[model samples]
Target: MMKEISLEGKTALVTGGASGIGYAIASEMIDAGAEVVIVGRRADKLQEATEKLGDRCRWYQFDVTHVDEYDQLLNQVDEKSPVDILVNNAGINIKKDFFDFRAEEFDRIVETQAKAPFMLSQAVAERMKERKSGNIIFISSLATILGMHEIQAYTVCKSGVKGLARSLARDLGPYGIRVNSLNPGFVYTDMLEKTNLKTPERLKEIEEKTPLKGFTQAKDLGMAAVFLASDAARFITGIDLVVDGGISSSFLI
Candidate 1:
């Protein structure tokens, strides 16, 4: 008999949960019996998502890039329900030549992807330490290892996110908190469709390269997040869980 993975009685706060991968994570967690708070900058998107997610899900309109407002956001959420799981999934990617990358553009990416997660994790970890339990999941990218072109700043930020997860896992383990990261590969999201998969040939090329010979779905990463957040992964921490459909494992001859 197999034990079931459940998140009953837990409350998860997922950043960027209005759409794409974040929405999938929020939906999966809610399905796994968790009460979820979806955070995003757009009120309309958040409202639409929460409606689609049903009663177990709610929304908060806030920009994660505004680092100064993290505490305020946390306090508001904590007042309603303490966050048992934190998913740092909010990020932006600006593709440009390495030489053409401006300092300001790099800073913007870092502020959203790297610095926001760090600060939010720190704040949530402090609260978790009080209860001696919590879970933090960073949404990293497969580009960190695969090294995609024209996304130098994005790659750097995502690489830092993985490092943050490892370091936080070590630091927060004693407090009964688990820190981990998920590296998604070629997910068929609006972002990918708008950016990388503009041409069917390009899409086919990527799919062929992946050992699974397909694109990863957003729900795939969501289910992975649910497992990590549930008791099933109680003993797991400080690991980068690659949800790339075996892309990382293959090499062309």
Candidate 2:
């Protein structure tokens, strides 16, 4: 039997879904028979992605880090689900030396990575609790598992997101809404492209340390998202599903 991942009759809202890992996940969900909504700050990017995704995908424009707009954003999503499967995949990283970090910089990182995920999960959970079923998947990062320098704010926010998932699972489990976290290691996304590490030498460096011997493809994480959100993971919750290709398992540092 071809192992099928069916999300029939479910609604999924994926933030940052215009490109990269989020886009990959949205595509998978669309293939799995779910109605997918892609949310991103850039309307142009979202529209471009929507047009490509056809009828299975829709687009929304909103800043995940904007505190004042979150409630409104959630209201706008209005996913028809006591089963709203939300992929809190939108995030930003602020990399700066400890001494160079500013309050605004720290706030921006925390708001997008930690606060926004929490609020979105909470909003979805409230609806799920009413119907007593839903799934909240958070896209944390492998950065949290290590104390990487320079991006202290990003690392800390991701760590906090994992903690929130664990605690929320405990509180929400009784109501049957599962909450979990997924962390991906060095994926060559646009974010990586923007970094200085996009060189051939840097790619080789990651391959050597990564036990899989190469960086993860965006589609790899997409499969992870599909499984975690599907009924296959029904018995799982409060877990940090690390998709880092064993990079965190060795003494690679």
Top lDDT prediction, candidate number: 1
Please state every model's RMSD to the true fold in angstroms: 1.4, 2.0
Candidate no. 2 TM-score:
0.93
lDDT of 1 by residue, 1-253 (tens): 0244888889999999989999999999999999999998899999999999999998889988776787898898888789999999998888778999899989998899899999989988889999999999999888888868788888889999999899999989999999999888889888767656678888888888888788899999999999989888989999999998788887740
True-structure lDDT of candidate 2: 0.83
Which clashing pairs does model 1 show? none
Best by TM-score: 1
Q: Mind giving the per-residue lDDT tens digits that candidate 2 earns over 158-233?
A: 8888899899999999998899998888899887666426488877888899987888888888888888888888
